[model samples]
Target: MEETRSQVDWLTRAVEALPDEMTFDAMQQLILSMVFLRQVSDVPEGEAQGRPTWEELVGQVAGKPDLVHQPVQRALRAWSGSYGKFRIDLDNEAVLGQMRSDSRVVDRALRDLIALLDRAGRAGAKGDLYDQCLARFSEDRVGGDYYTPRDVVRTMVGLMAPAPGDEVYDPACGSAGLLTEAARYVETHGGRPADRTGPVLRLFGQDINARTRSIAAMNLILHGLEDTLPRDIGTDNSLLHGSDAGEKYSVVLANPPFSMRMPLTDAGFVFWRYGPPPKSKADLAWVQHVLGALKADGRAAILLPNGAAFRGGAERRIRAGLLYDDVVAAVIQLPSGLFSHTRVPACLWVFSKSKRAHAATRVLFINAQDTGVQVSRGRRTLTGADAERIASTFNSWSKHDAADVPGWCRTVALEEVEAADFDLQPARYVAPVAAETAPGEDERRVRELTEELYEHFAEASRLEHELRDVLGT
Candidate 1:
């Protein structure tokens, strides 16, 4: 854990130094170059004798005249000397040069670099070089508003408890953070890293953005997900351009892009389980896609806008279908502004094909809006403790005879939801408590005094205006 933290720190620093305008693909290339340079610098002296300094190597292929190659060169020399017996050869130079010069070369380099780093990480290397590499790249490129926060990912992973044999997926995966987190969860939960085989071979994801698909693939590889390689990590524009009717997974977790639209074609017909989402609003469309992608026993967690809970029109029918089908498990209200890029209040919807020990007629609702701690001046986040509390609540509620905690959570019957127009908002069903009122006499006196002061101020302002008019006359 300490090593992971350190790697994350290094990644943060590396990304901080990179230009924010860099695309995910460009950032991946830069990371690949950095890793390759570091590896080359680690080679023995006899092998690396003819290798140029880092500056010279970068200068030779950077395709830019203004880039200061000298500093890089000096840094490389100093680093190599300090580390001892570091070397590079012609093949290494060619690889490094190609990675720096062309984007395609960088992609190949990134794949190879990640494969190497994965082997090293599993072998118990000093720092998580692969994690740092990806973190640095993510830091450089600003992700979308839908980018899932790491803490949220951790919490979701914990709640889902992805096992070794589970086939995890994210239909609208953004950089595959949830997928990577799921992989980590499996590894930590008594699953051998070497047991990369099994039904778990299925680590599926799809995204509308090609760049994001590539980034997601890279993210998966960085986290030691070797099963989803060059091909299985689908980047087909047609999939997003068309429709994917027959896809399923054991575990599905996603935070799809909020409030986006797509053309409705025959491909999109498969997502009409709850009726087609409005062309103006694709929120329900994504939900339908997730539900359709689930196996008979699959469990899914999706982050959705608050409106999905009670919106009228097509969305309402979708909500009705979800409740009627008994796939909805829990609805967790997240804190507002949890997303760094947007201020929309979000919620987590957990769905299951097969109800656990609890009745399918009941749904767990947790109001976690006020549970998170303020991380920045105006930004709040769920701490590990808060996440654990929420997860515990959900897990407990999954079992038979789960009790409700007043003001925090409740398990409402499906009939109650049906009566309430299938509204899933926690606040709607969770009874509100009456606040203690101040003494009546004191409150009345204060109100009277406040009204008197307002009258006096208005009169004074009127008199002042009159006096000014008189003076003008």
Candidate 2:
């Protein structure tokens, strides 16, 4: 924990050292790319002996402050040849060229950052540090697009429960948080071979954004995953284009962009089975793409907007198709504000191609809407305990010790789902159960409720007067 704090402090100082003209996007690229370069320098086989490593480059910068770009670019190119290209393009004028004349500024920042990382060593809490960078960017409201809060990533990973030898894929890999967490899950659970030559789990990921994919690559490298699984991340549009022909995975985890619109013609690949999702919303499109990407007997945990669970029209039909096929496994509604910069209520949809006999005919609905602890005025996050409880409930149900905990979780059969016109929203099925409370607590609740009621009554009275005046009555 202390290591994590120190790393964040180092990152703050590094960011502070940068020039004010650097946009968040450029700063992100610059910092993350340098970090990646620093890591790659440790591997001896990347280039012939004479080429300068990260340390050498930092030393070289002290003499000729203007000479940072070319050396870094050359090292990046040579290493990329030995260990496949990471696409952290130094040649991109937008990133480094904007400050080429003021190269001393950029060089100084890199020197300071690399010095901190070097002192921290190879095993520094780099993944957490990278995530902190992403979170800080999200707080600034510029990076929420690709940053999935780490807690949310952990919850999704726990549900998937990735194992050794599982082919895990994330269609919308983002920062590759879900993929890396899955790798860590396997490591924590202990099945990796002592003499492991290749990855214990085959991890693959695809994202539409190149810069995000670069971040994902750097993240994987920082986790030491590149040693076993080099260049596993790609820039494929999982929805518009299919993965390398006929490829499939045993586990798929994703938090795809919510409420994204797509051209109907572009999304026709997965439409034959699930039908085309509405152009205004690609929520179900992502779900179907993941389902299609799964191998028989595969399972997935996907996060989507709450509306996808109960929304009408094309999404409704798609939900019906998923339910009828017995592929929809569970829907866990998370609290609103769980994401940093957005207030969109999200839910996790666990899908299975082949369910065990116990969960084969039913879908588990978990009402974890009230489960998170507030971390800030507007942001909430699930604790480790909260995530474990949700994972255990689903795992127990899958293993046949199914119990319907009132207001929290319930395994509803296909018939009950059909009876409700296939509304998979947890609240629609799991009614809130009041908990036993102390007398003082109950009194406080009653007072709060009374105040809320009066507030509603006052609003209703104001609206009535406004209506009367508009009608001249």
**Can you give the TM-score per candidate against the true fold?**
0.69, 0.83
lDDT of 2 by residue, 285-373 (tens): 89988988899989999999989988889888998899889998899989876886556799999999988888877899999998889
> Top TM-score: which candidate number?
2
Taking the tens digit of each residue's C-alpha lDDT, what string does model 1 give over 442-466? 7885886697668669968998999
TM-score of model number 1 = 0.69
Model 1 regions lying over 4 Å from their true place:
1-146, 193-201, 228-231, 237-245, 264-268, 431-473
Q: Give the TM-score of candidate 2.
A: 0.83
Q: What is model 2's C-alpha RMSD?
A: 6.7
lDDT of 2: 0.76
Q: Give all candidates' CA lDDT scores.
A: 0.64, 0.76
